[model samples]
Target: MSVDPKTRPPRASAVRKAVQVAPTAVGAFYATSMETFRCMFKRPFHAREFVQQAWFIAGVSIMPALLMAIPFCMMFVYQINILLAEIGAVDLSGAGAGVAIIREIGPVVTVLVVAGAGSTAICADLGSRTIREEIDAMKVLGIDPIQRLVVPRVLASTLIGMFLNGLVSAVGLVGGYIATVYMQGASPGQYVTAISILTKLPDFLVSEVKAAVFGLLAGLVACHLGLNAKGGPKGVGDAVNQTVVFSFLLLFLANSVITTLALH
Candidate 1:
């Protein structure tokens, strides 16, 4: 016998509601992102909050960045050196390392760390605030939560993104150098000198730009999901997970688009 509609489990209804709300959620997120960007230039910048958030994000991210960069860059250089040695182009190993690390690996790795650590932290903080009704209370007090909370966090993420990009690039280059010189038996001087040969000013700029954009998007995703979170603590956890998923999705898409445009 079929169950009565009223007696049926609520799970199906909840699933349907989620499915129906997905598009609306996307639109709401986009609107919130635009508002956050617009508020960035508003008066009374939250310098203290920005600094705190930046320090927090950096603290969570730096060690992971180092651990990831060293092995990744070393492996990259090792593989490239092996191929180069086979073709007698071992002197160009630095060029290969420089191009890959600066243009792609640095920004990508930074994105992963920021999304995993920084964005999730932001989401958890705001999600907690949301579940505590703090955000609603702020609105009741006539405060724009986007201006007060989001702009600073987004800016901090962007700043940290650029900084992390530079840090990762440096560390990766050092790792690449070690791999090339010690492991692959290439000349250290050649590795250092040839690094700038294939990689140029534009590449550096694009990589930094990519990092900034990725950070900004990650912050936006986290904030949007956090602010919209409901159903209490479980909802907050879901929002944090969504923050990581959506941030990575947006970041990789933006990377592809920006890289393509820059290439042209």
Candidate 2:
């Protein structure tokens, strides 16, 4: 049976809503981003707030970063070692794992943890403040909420992202070393030497850049959604969810683009 025409959405109305949503979302993102940039460069900076938020983001992300770093590094190293052995390149295990981890896995895993943990925390805190009209109160008192809140959160997230990248890289290298030396029976000296020979300092720098970018974008998305959240508690929850999902999407795309440009 066909549905009643009257009960169906009008094409015009649906199109109108769709048209309105894209511009609204884009405008909101643009406004929040510009505000964040402005807040970042202005004087009378929120150093205390930045340090607190950075510490909080880093603290919350540690466990997840470790948990993510170890398993994936081990599994990748184990598999690559087997393949390399078939070609008589087993000694290259550390080089392969080290290069791969720093070039890609390090930043990706660290930012994944940061997005999952830190961004959610920022979103929730801001959402609660928004719902309670604390943000509005700040405005009424002549305090700029964006400067007081979003700027610090974004900086904190970026700094924490960079920190976590280092942590993940260290953990992944350690895990890969164990897997290569013991599980794969590779020579420890050869493994270390290969990594030293193959991976350069620039790889680490690029990875750090990716992590910082991911963190900054995640913070922007979270703060934007949280600041605009409506419908009370439910809206805040939705905004938090959106922050995680959108942050991940933006991050992976950014990773691909950054990797391509950096490598080529």
Identify the candidate with maximal TM-score. 2
The segments of candidate 2 whose C-alpha lies over 4 angstroms from its true place after superposition are 1-6, 9-20
The count of residue-pair clashes in candidate 1 stands at 0
> Which ten-residue region of model 2 has the weakest summed lDDT?
4-13
Candidate 2 residue-wise lDDT, 126-235, digit = tens: 99999999999999999999999999999999989998999899999999999998887789998888897678998899999999999899999989999999999999
Each prediction's total of clashing residue pairs, residues at least 3 apart in sequence or on different chains, is: 0, 0
- On the 0 to 100 scale, the lDDT of residue 17 in model 1 is 91
Which residue pairs overlap in candidate 2's backbone? Answer: none
Candidate 1 lDDT over residue span 1-264, tens digit each? 988989878999899999999899889998998899899999889899999999999999999999999999999989999998899999999999999999999999999999999999999999999999999999999999999999989999999999999999999999999999988788989999999899999999999999999999999999999898999999999999999998999999999999999899
Best by lDDT: 1
Instruction: Give the whole-model CA lDDT for all candidates, comma-separated.
Output: 0.94, 0.91
Model 2 quality (TM-score) = 0.94
